[model samples]
Target: MRTALRPHHLRWTGERDLAHAIYGTVVGTAAMATAGAHRTLGGTVATVLVTVAVYWVAERYADALAAAVRGPDRRARIGRALRQGWPTIEAACAPPVVLVAFVLVTGDLRAGVVVALAVSTVMLSALGHAAAKHAGATRLVAVGCATGSAVLGVVVILLKTFLH
Candidate 1:
């Protein structure tokens, strides 16, 4: 049972970080693009990738810092922290992919932002539902939690609209 639980534990941490990075990147990109912060799709993609890398480094350092508080007797693996936070990079790819595809196919940056936001919202809901299931939530509770998580995505959309 203990061995079985370890993988689940690892996933929980990685998923949380991934979800956070996804939502942040989606919202940030949408807001910037809508506000005309980036003049080109290439520039927007660069900003998104840089944002993800910055967040990953911040989280990795945070994990190591927290572990350090527990002292040298329980050594922290800085490499493990890097590995655990790697999902952040994966999650950030969705927005750029959407942005590039829409820009190329439709030549509409606004549409790209909108579609990317929707994609990120869906991913957030899925992440939340999975998290609830991992916690053994009841069916209804899991759905409620998922909707709740999705609200964060909605907030991003609202901000983008207003910023635009």
Candidate 2:
């Protein structure tokens, strides 16, 4: 019997998907954070979901098309594309949960948006650190990776503050 692979044993596809997820997270967080003042918490969350879904679909379609050109089994290529693109959609899951929870508890949509952005920033930082460590990066390099991911989220939040 084969033992299950450990989380640390990441394949190239896992790394690629992680990168996609990080990109998606940044996009989704930015979309909601920079939304207009008239936007409600639910509307912002829905917008994020729809934006990520559209991105996910577009990525999968492109990937599938590329695979179709290289292979004979269209169904398998489509399935592979869908699986590969799933992490991007999954990346959008966490921030909205934080948003909804904070909004429900504090009854403040703006505060919820702040909390959600913060939570997603932290998550991205963690993911960057893990990815770097998994690739045998030095501790300093891992920290730098984490900081870079965090800065992406922070920049978006800063833009929201200034723009809205």
Candidate 3:
């Protein structure tokens, strides 16, 4: 079981981080728009819940993926698998944390959520590339994902502006 959990653990961490970014952005935006400091507390709570949910979902996904990759001798390979996966996890998670912090501080929740989603998507793609030994692919994927996210953000903002 432990062995089966190793590979996907890092990916799960990344996903949880992504969720934190999203929750932080949403809560912060709500707080800022409503002129209520108490919204910060709510945002914090949302962030925690989102993070926890992300962790749980990511953990399950990672375990399943690891199990698929590891096969019968997965237990024996646990340490090696963890060692290999840790860096990818770290790489995937770091950007979202920084971006979330920036969004929260700047009170730009919408942009933050879009960026976070984009980053999360790119990171997932990078992880796939990591497994395949194609580092260059991650760069392209990130750019594409980020561009798409930005477009979505703009569209959302425009719609909100016009509709409201």
lDDT of 2 by residue, 62-85 (tens): 988888888578788777877785
lDDT for each of the candidates?
A: 0.68, 0.80, 0.44
Task: Please give, for residues 95-139, the per-residue lDDT of candidate 1 as tens digits.
Answer: 678878988999998787788878877776776777777678899
Candidate 2 contains a number of clashing pairs equal to: 0
- Pairing residues by index, what is the TM-score of model 3? 0.33
lDDT of 3 at 136: 42
Candidates 1 and 2 compared: the better one by lDDT is 2
Clashing pairs in 1: none
For residue 108, model 1's alpha carbon misses the true position, in angstroms, by 1.0
Stretches > 4 Å off in candidate 1: 1-35, 73-76
lDDT of 3 by residue, 60-161 (tens): 467556765865777656544433323323333443464558676887655554454455444444434343233343666755644553453344444434
> Candidate 2: global Cα-lDDT?
0.80
What pairs collide in candidate 3?
8-62
Please state the error at residue 149 of candidate 1 in Å: 1.4
Sorted on TM-score, best first, the list reads 2, 1, 3
